[model samples]
Target: QCTVQLGGSDQWGNITAGTDLVRRVAGGKAFGVVSPLLTNASGTKFGKTEVGNVWLDPELTSPFAFYQFWMNTDDRDVIGFLKCFSLLSQHEIGELEEATRVEPEKRIAQKVLADEVTDRVHGETGLAAARKATQALFGGDISGLNASEISEVFGDVPSSELEKSRLGGDGLQLVELLAESGVASSKGDARRAIEGGGIYLNGERIQDVSQALSIEDAIEGRYLLLRKGKRAYHLVAVCE
Candidate 1:
């Protein structure tokens, strides 16, 4: 039997009951350690109960998302968060505090906190993936990223699926594809946007309304990136 169980204070009753049962049934000594629950600056407990949780599972929350969650921590709460979440020495944390005061714009404290926690939770590989995605997304040089990486980077962006066969033969016209994918309001709007030098395909400006999207235009032959403006992105995913 385990000697001790640790949990939040709310589990005190349940843990104590288990301890008692073990003591009486097996004549074993067990202990329960319940501590006050930790909450974010907003008073939401850091757990499954909170909608803003930074999940450990890459499937539920990608490493990029996890990294950004910590990086966006409030300046007021970062020091306290570093204290609770990271294994940084107090001296190191003090140095970070000084850095924060000196250069808050650089966000050194939040960066360090996010890096330490993400590295600890996700390991070197996950941290690398997170940083890579972050740089690609921020730098806008996504031509080299595979479809999976693009999907991870734009998980929340609007997306549409296209049949693999559609990119064959005549291929789908850029205007029609944009209209179908909701990147533009209609074929006319798509043409206008293309002519206005606002429509982009895979980050390149599209000036020809007659352009067609083919499998070769897709990253990994599975995804097409459509942009109506600088910041509006739409993903066209091709499937069998």
Candidate 2:
């Protein structure tokens, strides 16, 4: 029985037309139910960016990036997003709303929203990787990441390749390497940023421009992570 139909609110007319056609053909009643299209608090639609739609294809958007996209939801829009996306019951959603109102800093709502959507799209293992990558990015801990996980974490980040031999003896100078790795525009820029105390190597601050990045600095012994600031990251790989 085609007793119920669902679609975006904009498709209400089309939904009703289909229901009517179904009734006439099958001699049975049907109902159409439409929901509002998902939108951010600014009224901008979801699933879109400057480039294109946020696709469900894993190849199009990695699970880690997908989870991050939801995790960055604005506070005002999170509760509504939870209701629309999460499979949680109404009581659970209501509790989350209260928690949001009480302690927004916890980001409990955003976390739940990200977890639910990521799991639905990519599964539990994908969710775990995303969470681990998130922690590694913000918390500056890469010791636990394998080579593939490190690559996944820095997939969208700026990256470069250098001779593995360069990291052998005295290692590469911090300022010159930063510039070459595209973390800074020029050697002078790198030096200034380092002197200003903003350069980070594998999540650790590099206050001295003379600091050498040795082979030991590579995460998993093949990659060096450079950060110009808290968010801008560059990955440098050592090649034979």
Alpha carbon deviation, residue 143, candidate 2 (Å): 1.5
Q: Give per-model CA RMSD.
A: 3.0, 4.2
In the predicted model 2, the residue pairs found to clash are none
Cα deviation of 6, candidate 1, in Å:
1.9
Whole-model lDDT per candidate: 0.87, 0.85
Q: After superposition, how far is residue 223 of candidate 1 from its true place, in Å?
A: 0.7
Model 1 lDDT-worst window of ten: 136-145
Minimum summed lDDT over a 10-residue window in model 2 is located at 45-54
How good is model 1 by TM-score?
A: 0.81
- lDDT for 25 in candidate 2 is 91
Candidate 1 on 1-240: residue-level lDDT in tens? Answer: 479999999899999999999989999999999999887677778889778787898889888899999988888789999999999999999999999889898999998988998899899988888888877666666766778889989877899999999899979899998888888899999989999999878767888889987889998888888887777889888899
Quote the lDDT for 133 in model 1.
83
Clashing pairs in 1: none
